[model samples]
Target chain A: MIEIHDLHYRVGAAPILSDISLSLPEGSLTALIGPNGAGKSTLLRLMARLEPLQSGRITVEGLDLATTPTDAMARTLAIMGQQNSVASRLRVRELVGFGRWPHHQGRPRAADREAVEAAIDAFGLQPFAGRFLDELSGGQVQRAFLAMTFAQDTAWMLLDEPLNNLDVAHARALMARLAQLVQDTGRSVVAVVHEVNYAAAWADHVVAMKHGRIVAQGAAEAVLTEDLLSDLYDTPVEVSRHDGRPLVLHHHSHSRIADLSRGRLPDRARLS
Target chain B: MRFAAGLGLAALLALMLVSLGVGAAEISVRQARSDAWTMLVLMESRLPRTLAVALAGAALAVSGTLIQSLVRNRFVGPDTTGTSESAALGLLAVTILAPASPIWVKMVAASFAAMAGTALFIVVIRRLPRREVMLVPIAGLVLSGVLGSIVTWIAWQADLLQYVGVWMSGEFSGVTAGRYELLWVAGLAAGLAWVGADRFAILSLGDGVATGLGLSTASVMRFGLVVVAVVSALVVTTVGMVPFLGLVVPNIVARVMGDNLRASLPVVAASGAGLLLACDIIGRLLIAPYEMPVSVILGVLGALIFLVLLYRRPAHA
Candidate 1:
């Protein structure tokens, strides 16, 4: 389990996150969902130690995040941020093979090679293993990065907006893969998901943030309610049951454009 | 890849033979009458000159590769980044301050200056927006120009312009057994770069990914800075400045072998040595008896090749 206590982050006198405390359960998939400027990504970065702790304490699996050696921390958790621009022209196999760096440093043993190949197979990258990363499509490159994080083989995985540029099919496929990994291997995953339905469909736990504070967090069914989500995003929403889970519909039936077309619009101040 | 490396090595060996035979005094090794004279020439001048050329070539290329990795820019090299010019400035300062100082002291002083100059360049470029890739080398070139003018003005004031001029243009005519040993240290720096190739390759991916992968990016970058500074300083103090060997060699090698430095570093080093040796041989043969500096030929060819690189399809695609 990951524990956070009294976390406060600020940038140049502007507070980004304030007085936050949360504990994420082990062996479960958690989704962090929030509107823009809610500090969701900053919170995840802090938990992964990508950002230095300013005033908080975080512990992962009984190891203090502030003092643990980076290599040891790497074995405990793997975080993939939203950097899609790769500078070097590396082959997919070589890029995936770097995930074993913490284990082998520079010399790769046969076991490490086996793990790399296993990761490649897991991601269905055998056909493109020898190709350079720049040669592949956007979705394929996303999968390659995902395969690298998986090849790290840590107890916890953190992904920030993994579905940024992926198509609907690819996004659904990635969510399924993450769910299967959590179920079969009992590894923990925490992802920042924008689409609430994805969280509703797959996340075992959901965390909602607003104004740098945790608005609500609980089991998926308990926290994803019609009133809470509508208030969270400042838009009216309807929640219904689908396959024994909550499905949120937030797209408005009568949009402002429709009001404008029907000659029932208010002043431009309200529209702006 | 192995076949290409083998061919390069073979060609480099042939170039070394040609370099040894094409000096000013014609002493044939096949003639038994001047055997002692031939051996003396080979030992004192020919061998050291050839070896110095190869070592300086490899060191400059590796140094350039390290800088490119640290800066994450393809076009910046030691020549353009104020490294060589700063070293020349240091050499001038030491010459003017203590005319009787030993050569080793001068080399150390030059290395310190080069480190400072390169660090300033990094700090300057770090402020610019990263997506504008062309801004980096342009900044480096401007820094080089500023440092070059300072060195020239100081040299002119101190009545040391002739010495500084020799150091500005690279040549092998004055290289002998005892005078050209500093480049062996530069060669050692290249070997160190090879040993740390994996870290450099990882570093090129950027700070966030490298740290996520558990590398101490700060320490690795510091080590790289020291390597680049020392190599550039040694080359400048020994054989003067060799332009574009660093820039051209690494790009050509990457074009053929991609940017996996561990797989391509050895080839980069060999190709650097091979290209420089070929240039030196051409300079020697072009205007026999009255030699032209290798930098002139390299400058001309490097600019042409650099234009081609700029106009070609983006290598990222």
Candidate 2:
């Protein structure tokens, strides 16, 4: 389990996160859902120690994040950010092989090699394993990065905007994979998901944030309500049940023509 | 891979023999094999010169590879990043302040100066928005120009222009067995690079990813910076500045082998050594008896290669 206490992050004078505290359960798929500038990525970066904690205490799986060594923390949790600009002549297989670095350091044993191959297979990247990253499309490259993070083989995985650039099919496939990982391997997963339906469909726990504060956090069915989402995003949202889970239907419901015909211009459209 | 390395080794040996035979002193391979005086000349002058050329080339190229990986910019190298120029400044300062200092003292001074200069370059480039790939080397070139002019002005004021001139043109004509042994230290630094090849490769993946992969990015970056500074200082102190050997060799290797330093570093080193040996041979042959500096030949060739790299399809970020 990951625990946070008294976390307050600021950039210069402007606060990014303030007096935040939360606990994430182990062996569950958790989704961090928020609009832009919600500090979802920043919070994840702090937990992973990619960003230094200013006035916060975080512990991941019993190890203090501030005191743990980088290699030790790496074995505990693996993270993949949205922007992976590895601009070099790197093959997809070689890039994924780097995920085994914490385990093998430099000298890869047979077990490490097998793990790399397994990760490549897990992402279904075998067809383009030999190809360079630049040769692949954006979605394919996104999958390759996901494979690399999986090859890390940690107990916890944190991904920031993992679905970016991925088409709908790949996105759904990745969410299914994350769900399967949590169930089959008992590894805890935390992902910042922009698409709420993904979190609605797969996330066991839903954390909704607005203005750097968690507005609601609980089981997916309880937290992803229409009233909470509409309040969280400052826009109308509708939720319907599908396959015994909450399915958010906010896309077509907030049309501009319907709003103008109703004679009151939307506040968000005016500001933008 | 093993076969390629073996073939490279065989070719290097063959080139070393040829380089040892051809020099201003007019000693053939057969003569050196039979005559004792010719053999002494081969061991003392020709052998040292050849080894110095190879070692310096390999060291510069390795430093270039390290800088490129650390900066995550393909265009920057020791020469472009003001490393060589600042080393010259250190050499000049030592020559003017303490003319009787030991060679090692001068090398230490130069290495310290090179480190400071490179650190400044890194700091400046770090603040830069990294999207524009061409801006990095352009920034480096500006830094090099500034550092180089300062050295030149100081040399002129001290009436040490001629001495600085000797250090500026990378010529192996003056290299003797005892004078060129410092290059071995540079060679050792390159060897260290090979040992830590995987770490450096991870480093090229950027700070966040490298950290996520369990690396102390700062420490590894410092290690690489020291390697680059030490290699640059040694090369400048030993044979003056050999421009672009570092930039050209690794790039060509990367084109064929990609940037997996573990698989490609040895090839980068060997190719660097081989290319420098060939260039030095060309320098000796071009103006027979009266030799041109290897820097002159490398300057022209390196510039051509740089242009080609610039116009070629953009490489990965």
Candidate 3:
């Protein structure tokens, strides 16, 4: 389990994340959903220790983040952020091989090789294993980075906006793979998702944030209601069931207030 | 791997010997042995100068490779990092402040100053919120400019401008046996770097990756910087500042070869030696009795090569 308490992050005088406290249970897929400037990326970076926690306490399985060595934390948790601009000269296999670094420290053994190969196979990257990262498309590069994180083989995986540049089919495939990892392997995953439908369809737990604070969080079915999402995004929204999941309809032409005002016009409203 | 390195080593030796033999002096092998004075001049003057050039070239090249790897930047070098400039300032300080200071004292002072400059660069880089890697070399260039101006000002005030000019214009003319002994420090530094090549390569992956791999990023960076500073300082103290040998050689080697430090290190070293020696010979032959500085030749050639490299798009790795 990962726990964050009294998280207060400030960037030069303005508060980025204020009094944010949350706990992520073990063996679950939690999707962080929010609008722009919602601090989802900041929260993920803090959890990964990519940014220092200024006024908070974070612990993973009873080990305090401040006290645990980075290598030890890396062995337990792996993070892949949205910025995947790695030096393009590196080969796909070499990039994935870096995931084994925390274990072998560059002197890879047979087991490390096995893990790398497994990760490649898991991501269906065997065909492009020898290719350089520059040679691959954006979606293929995203998969390669995901394979690297998977190769780390940690208990916890944190992905920040993993679906940014991915096409529809690839995005669904990635979500399915993450869900399988959580369900079958009993590993935990936390991903910051921009598209709410992906979260509603796939996430076991949904966390909603606005202006750097969590507005709603719970089981997907409960927190993903129309009222909560409408309040969360400050826009009129309607939720309908699709394939036994909440399908958010937010792109309608008429506003809720406009519809209500027209309904009160009685027989004259039907003249048009 | 060891066998391949040995082959490279043999090649470097042959190049070194051939470079020593062929120079403007044109001393035939038989005549070199017949006259005692001629033998003495060749052995004492030409031999040490050649060896110093080779050692300085190799050291700077290796140091440049290490710096580039540690910073994960392509254009880094000892001069660009302000190391050689700071070292020159250190030497200048010693000459002005302590006129009676020994050569060893001056070398130590320069090494320490170079280390301090590198540490300052690292600190400045760490403090920036965005952590722009390009700023490192820029900061280094700024520091070099500042330190270089100070050195120049002091040298001018103290009437040591001639001495400073000689040191700044890198050449092999003044190198003799006693003066060239300082270059052994560079050799030792190169050896140390070679032994820690794996750690340096891991460091090229950035601090997070290196730290995640159980290596202390700060310690590794500090170690690599010290090695670069010490070697660069020693070379500057003995011969002078040899520009572009460090930057151009490593980049060319990495382009031709791969990023693997262990595999490319010797190639960088050899290429550095070969290029410097060829430049030195060209400098010697440019004028019959008088010769241009090796630094000038290297500077012009390096600029042309750099422009060519810039214009030519690199093929994807």
lDDT of 1 by residue, B116-205 (tens): 999999999999998888899999999999999999999999888998898899888889999999899999999999988989998898
- Stronger candidate by DockQ (1 vs 3): 1
- Per residue, candidate 3 scores C-alpha lDDT tens digits across A43-76 of 9889888788899899977779888998788898
Q: Summarize candidate 2's per-residue lDDT along A123-213 as a digit string, tens digits.
A: 8899999998877888888888888899999999999999998889989998998899789889999999999999999999989988888
Candidates in descending TM-score order: 2, 1, 3
Ranking by DockQ: 2, 1, 3
**TM-score of chain B as predicted in candidate 2:** 0.97
Colliding pairs, model 2 = A87-B316, A87-B317
Off by over 4 Å in 2: A251-272, B314-317
- What is the lDDT, from 0 to 100, of the residue B271 in candidate 3? 79
Candidate models: Cα lDDT each: 0.88, 0.89, 0.81
* Model 1 clashing residue pairs (backbone): none
Going through the candidates in order, their DockQ values are: 0.53, 0.62, 0.25
- The docking category that best describes candidate 1 is medium
TM-score for chain A in each prediction: 0.92, 0.92, 0.93
